[model samples]
Target: MSRELDLKSEKSIEDLKKLSKEELIIKILELEKLRINKNELVNEGKKIKRVFDFTKCQKRHVAFKLLYLGWDYQGFAKQDDTEKTIEHELFHALTKCCLIESRQTSNYHRCGRTDKGVSSFSQVISLTVRSNGNNSKELNYCKMLNRLLPKDIRVIAWSPVIDNFSARFDCTSRTYKYWFPRGNLDIDIMNNAVQHVVGTHDFRNLCKMDVANGVTNFTRRIISANVKLCSNNDQFSKSRGYDMCELTIVGQAFLWHQIRCIVAVLVLIGQHKENECVITNLLNIDNCPRKPQYSLASDLPLNLFYCQFENVNWIIDNESVTEVISTLQHNWASHMIKTTMLGEMLKNIEDLVPDSINKQSDCLLQGVKSKIYQPLMKRPASESLENRIKHYTKKGRLKIENNEKN
Candidate 1:
């Protein structure tokens, strides 16, 4: 290149170097333009290369272990015309990382679809993803995904699985945890009532029937139901009023709003508005043919705690683990500091104001309190599953009649 440039020049290299400053400025501009033009030509030629070729890489079926605080999402699964979902953010990250071309081609399966405002500590999903043929220089799945996903959502671990694994069907049991604040309620009665929920039984009375979606089966087996106090510390000393208590329910599968409905009944039992017999009555479907209408417990504190699958070994990336831990620690510290400041402000207000003036029930901690205690039996009956089916049948028949007349 230097020889060619010297051959084309009017002066030898030594003479050109000794040119005046003005002459040097003109030459430098000419050279820079030439360099830029060459770069543009090279970039234009490179555009012909393919962005990605799926055929060049091998695929592996894997399960991603994830956790998220779902206060801001609609649910775990994707929905039509909505971007506020855990699956939406997950797919965006997966596509950005070139893990899967799109969700349609990924062969994805989620263990459970949690409701809006629900959270998860160990949600799992299995999908086929692009992989290095020999597992050498594999992509860091956890760190790569977490960096692209929202801070509320994190991928904790991943496991390569056999070709035929499905996250939803292969799971033996799923555990859900519901955290609540203990108010003026009886824990012993609530525990006794929860005992009846164990074993296989028809739980139509305890769930919102999705008969409209073609769900006819209401029977679900409960592995266990346990209630325990999580902390003795004064939750209200921090301005939140009740101490933390948790209810863990393990089952093979669940109905829509099943766990939340169960918590509603347990709350009534604890408040002495409903007896332990209410559970048995609800279970005896022949006697209590219809469910009574009652408000479902709040969804914010419910979490998909853990999922147990069959013999799949999980692989952990060490660097991703460190990153996830550090991120969580930083978030926790920020929230803790804010909460402490709020507590101090509340204490000062209480010191100035009379107790009578600030006697609002700690409704935020515990659920909304009933002005009058109504027994479950005395409450208005909710439409039974059979009634819902009948209503839909009639509606369909009416539509057919209208069409025929027209």
Candidate 2:
């Protein structure tokens, strides 16, 4: 299989010059043909392995925990005319692994549907799959799923569940964490501002009201909300320019764009543009009956941190765990190096600029902060949910006063 040329290429230029031009041309052509032949042979030897044949066994309900980076995905749920979704890829892998014949027959249920550009560390799903049968050794679900899934999506753990288990309704609570750079905004003010989010409240003004989609209930219970810095006191350190902070929210359920909307209001308060009374005003449906227009916080930093369930013990495959860890470490190292390189370039560019023309030195907060410091109430408003529902209803695009079911 060795393609070691009969004519050596490492010979000196003097040796090559000794040959006539026609001889050199022929030698070059011969070497190119040999290289192409070697590549074709190598490719011929690398055919895809045959997929595993599923066993004839009983079907069982199971739950699996997964993690994914969502920057390249449209969202966590499948949609028409789009192939770039987490659920779409998951179903594809499940089919490839012969775990489920099809999603329609699997009785599938997801814990929550994350929006585009939002990631998950412990997203869970429950589904029925062909199993190794009762009293038999269980299959390595994590390993089998990961083998067919994309590198960015990995199943870390799985558990056997009762026949009636559903990942969506059986879950008691869900937690989300939003990360952001610690910019020049006032953290204490934001922390104080966000305390209003706890407990049961009518959040019609705090979330994207989907009345047209029949989401008429605006009340939801928040278990807790906390905001904290990742480090003790590194604000003065130049090397640690982009110190991170997170706001974690635990709730029974959340509406569409709820967390992002909350974060946007908190950012407004932190910037001293909006008063803390704005939150109270929004929560009191009597005062602010409809949601005012405001930009949502960026989605890339939001993550579904944990999904809570009861009476289920997860089975971990050690080999799959190791592979998942290695994959994450490789991704982390690559991004870290790129960030460092970009920082160096920015520093060099700033240094080369004259003092008179140079703008302020920067951190990683280029698009994180609001461009204009306007009070939330003073900004131009977009159409409210009530207005949208009326407009659509008048055009016969929606049913009048329809309600969301489950």
Residue-pair clashes per candidate = 1, 0
- Cα shift from native, residue 236, model 1 (Å): 5.9
Worst 10 residues of 1 by lDDT: 397-406
| Pairs that clash in candidate 1 | 236-241
Query: In lDDT terms, which candidate is top?
Result: 1
Global CA lDDT computed for model 2: 0.81
TM-score of each: 0.80, 0.78
RMSD of each: 10.0, 12.7
lDDT by residue for model 1 (1-406), tens: 9988877774676777889999999998999999999999999998875588887878999999999999889998889978999999999999988899988999998988998889999999999998886666766789889889998899989988988899888989999999876765566788889999999999889988777666767888999998877876453563333456789999988888899889988877877778899999998999898998788888888999999998878778888777778888998999879877875766677677555232221342244557876788878887777777788777763221210000
Please give the CA lDDT of all the candidate structures. 0.82, 0.81
Candidate 1 deviant stretches above 4 angstroms: 1-50, 234-241, 346-370, 394-406
Q: What TM-score quantifies how close candidate 1 is to the native fold?
A: 0.80
lDDT of 2 at 338: 90
